[model samples]
Target: MSKLVNKSQCVVICCFPANYTVGLTTVVEALALGIPLICTKNVQMPMDIDHEHCGITVEPGDMGGWEKAVNYIAENPDVASDMGRRGRELAEKVYNLDNCAKDVSAVLKTLIKK
Candidate 1:
């Protein structure tokens, strides 16, 4: 999976625009492997895929939007590569396992204290 993701130009996540699954680990996994992304709106968050330049987001059923996004990546290979690099950096520096573990531990400690 890592190899495939890294080799790919981009990853496309097809989900309902309103389906709020932003915290899905798959997004992190893809980013960690340095793959650019194109996903439905609301599929990812915290990292702000679009704003962070890690990916593009489109409305759920918007085929035209999908085409434009795909074309953008295809037409601009350098930009796509940059997006992947940014995604990898974001994953490593912010969404790494160590950070997640620490966050979970903090919450657990708080619950225990309560």
Candidate 2:
């Protein structure tokens, strides 16, 4: 899954009707790989996908919106590439393991101090 996702141009996470917190790992992988995404809005991290223009989000169960978003990305290669670059930047700055560890350490230290 990781190799396939890393090699893909874009990833579509269609977690509709059953919103589990499953697709976030895929999302992070896609971000790290600089791939654009099309995802259901009910996923655990819609803000991360939408805020950075890393992808398009459609309401869960909205097939038409999904199709439109896919088509838009397909038709706009430049925009898609830019989104991918932004996603990579976001992944490095926010989602990298080093940053995550730092964040955790900070919280733990604060808790210990308190």
State every prediction's TM-score relative to the real structure.
0.85, 0.78
The TM-score, computed over Cα atoms with residue i paired to residue i, of candidate 2 is 0.78
lDDT of 2 at 102: 93
Clashing pairs in 1: none
Best by TM-score: 1
**C-alpha lDDT of all candidate models, in order:** 0.84, 0.84
lDDT (10s digit) by residue, model 1, range 1-114: 667666888888877655457536777887888888998788335666888889898887999999999999999999999999999999999989899999999999999999
**lDDT (C-alpha) at residue 56 in model 2:** 91
Give the Å shift of residue 100 in candidate 2. 2.3
Clashes (backbone N, CA, C under 3 Å), per candidate, total 0, 0
| CA RMSD of all predictions | 2.1, 3.1
Estimate, for each residue in 4-75, the C-alpha lDDT of model 2 and write its tens digit: 777766899888555556588888888889999998786456355787899998888888998899999989
